[model samples]
Target: MLLALIEDSLEREGWKGVSPMEILEILEREATLRRRGSITPNDVRSVFREVKKARETPVLETLRKNLTFALPKLPVSRHKVKMEEFIAASKNMKLYSDQEKSREIMDAVYLIRPKETRQQIGGLHEIKDRILNQISLAFNPRMAELGYDSNCRFLLLGPPGTGKTLLALVAAAENNVAFIKVRGGELMSGASYHGEPERRIKELFGLARQRSPCILFLDEADAIFWGGDATSNKLLAQIKSELSELTSKDRIVVIATSNKEELIDRATRDRFEPHVYTVPPPQDDDEWNEVVEIHLQKIKPYLAPDVEGRKITRMFRRERILSPRGVAETITEAHRLWASEIAAANEVRAATDQEKRTVALARFRADLERIEHMLPAIK
Candidate 1:
């Protein structure tokens, strides 16, 4: 009740116009008239401080908005300001010390509100369903009522460019939650001072908890958990503690991706057991066709009309462009080559649609040949 009153006053008069003493006096008067328990100035001030922090802390504000979406019953007011806007405001407010820490945390962690859905992911239908189901259970309020385990930890094992990152983004987006991505190497590198890495791990998990119904993606997990040194062991211990601390009520799902699975320790790997999934490159013609078509559609506007997508897909397959990333890069490089030619031609005369289409097809074939020798053949 006191918190509501403080919030109301702050909303009406702004934080500058409100005073803790005034709130204390109001509480004291109510207590005296009602013959209730005595109210102390310290009590009123403490509540006031909490309200002040909620309003000032940018991360809290971000989490509040996320909570408002996840749990409508919560009485958190919506803020028009974004996370970056709040950080900018904090700079002028001379809250540099706190803001600096927040900025560093943000720098190490990449926050993404993903718009990609499972449908956007070409193949991996079984993997997609499994991930979505796990995240759905984690976010479902009914699961908590039924005493179901809602917290999940996933370790995505895959080679480079196998779309592990995309899977994580899609899971968050499908669940209508925030995605916080942290590279293992980057997180460790930021820990220049003694115990800084452990501190960062705590902050990262703390932030994830605050932003419940979120996906905390740790990319390149090998880099952080691979080392056998004292620092690596300490960092690993801290991460284990954080993961173990997650309860069913916390809607945070941790997804760690690693290309070098051998580097991860046994204990660290066990933390994500029963949920570990290996994401492989496109294995069949249908998957390749779909993935190739998806990438082609993205660059369709720039391609020549006569450039056949089917031919391109076959070419990708023949050249062993197995991974989705490899296919996308091949397409992108081909487009870049064609675009450059068009730009150069514009200097003399604007190229016709026919001319552009011919050049685009040629470039696509040329890039395929170039990368055929460059790309390592899948063993």
Candidate 2:
């Protein structure tokens, strides 16, 4: 709590230096005013020293830590030549006047590697196989020459948090193709003021065409295609028409997601033909266990080292609440409680590993009760 407060204060003041003693006095005064237990001046000094040391680290080092891959082991000359060749190739591609717009659009989407293969994706194995095979067939020129449709356009209908978005990233990673993602609302918002939306949509598709053998994922697709009286909204009609045209392009696989499949217009629905897969939430005990295990693994690194996944899985199985999102939220809430416990003990900066594990487990058990209360009623 003190470190966070100090960090916030530093940011607010534009990082102009503040004396450790001055901060200690201010915190002591605040503690008195709030009738909370006071922190020792020694602890305050320790936190201030650590924060200062942290600030001395270079920003580039922090960024390097978050990178997925290390720098290539190529000679500088060869690397420079490769970069220049890539730049030249990009320039030679005649796509649009403002190609950066499409680049910006692609930048916002997350590029996931194929760590979670089709088998690792809990349930929906058959649907996963269908998607994987479709992508393979569509990308094969021989299949097209043999009179196949070769259009890999698909509509993934599912409830929220059923991994529709994850599947798109998985597909892109599986095929080693570039994944270009855009939300339906972004298109709608762009279409609102001027005719720019339609032009932008067309340009985006053109960019996708330039980068063929890529997946173009439209998230929350129903937002653009859903609603009463499409003729009443010119923006909606225009955007939908643009999407309809864009999906027909070959080698440009389009995957769209919708929570409410019924709301999508028949015309738009027709475009994503013959492969509309429904991804429902985990239902039975086995599926729920898988969901629990998947999320527990995701959050395991953030929690105490000694905290076992099996224990958490057993507890989750014992509970009545079992949404994939709900499990994640519950675990997150437990971590928050653990942080609070550390803060209460006044050893947030110097907490021992054993202390952290004990507090975290206690908090996890407590939060499960809170989560049970928060769970939605079974319909």
Candidate 3:
């Protein structure tokens, strides 16, 4: 609380609009951060919108302009190549354009790599196989006409750290498709002049359509699409309408993920073909052991005597902990802390043995607690 008050006082000036990353940093420092997360593509989109709004604020306009100028310019040849590619395709459907968004969508898709596949994504072999097979059929023009009775749409519903987003990433990667992620809550800013969100939706879907064989994923698929607000609901309708019209793999594949599928609208729910529930960590004893072994393999290379980071994972993997994403994050953070220790170590000053022990212990304890919280909600 005292730290929060200090952070609150540290704001530059009155009505200082902050970017989403900055807000997260302050919240983490104040120890007020609550939500567990993997920062799904949807969340990134939401944060992008928030930061866009902050940049548009009059107080920060100059700062935003400066930031844009300081950033390295995107390659010119790539932009022209995408423009030519989209233009060639646009000839088939008169609806496409080379607007601001056409470039944005092209740039976004360009960042997607073919190498991001299910083979690289850890865990869920059976679920991955099932989902992949379904997508494979769905992606084929011949199978869509077979009158298969399956929910064409899917919901990757599960608790935090269960690799829901990772599965979506792998699916897109394997399918050789672009992943267009949209966040629901960030779609609604205010009723007055937030038509921008609606426009963004249209452009996003249009781009998906234009770039056939792409995946449209709504990360927190339940938030704004619910039937509570009139305008926001209409925005969702814009999405469903597009999805309903799309018939083949050539027409963009739709994959939606939500932690809470029950809250999704019944009618809206029908649009999705199969609602696959992601199984969280099992209560079975052996599963957590697998997690520990996988992560400890990564940890072993980074550990040092100064940190006293003896691997507890070698003895036991008792707790049903460490989902694939959890393992990745743990490794990343451990590396970060160790790098900090190395950087902080100098002839001028060194961490006391107790200081290093306290830091190391806190990290290990946090890792265990995260595992505890990530246990599967099933038997």
TM-scores, all models, native as reference:
0.67, 0.57, 0.55
List where candidate 2 sits over 4 angstroms from the true fold: 1-116, 193-196, 227-249, 299-322, 339-379
Could you tell me the C-alpha RMSD of candidate 2 in Å? 19.2
Scored by CA lDDT, what does every candidate get?
0.69, 0.58, 0.51
The number of the candidate with the highest lDDT is 1
The alpha-carbon deviation from the true structure for residue 310 of candidate 1, after best TM-score superposition, in angstroms, is 3.1
Q: Which pairs clash inside model 3? A: 151-273, 151-274, 152-273, 153-272, 153-273
In model 1, what is the error at residue 210, expressed in angstroms?
2.8
Residue range 11-126, candidate 2, lDDT tens digits: 54344444433553454444334332223323444444444444434444665788777744322121111122222222222222233444434433432223445644665545
**lDDT at position 164, candidate 2:** 83
Q: How do these models rank on TM-score, best leading?
A: 1, 2, 3
Q: Worst lDDT window (10 residues) for model 1?
A: 88-97
- Give candidate 3's error at residue 336 in angstroms: 2.2
The whole-model C-alpha lDDT of candidate 3 against the native structure comes to 0.51
The reply for model 1, stretches above 4 Å from the true place, is 1-104, 190-192, 350-379
Worst 10-residue lDDT window for candidate 2 reads: 74-83
What are the clashing pairs of model 1? none
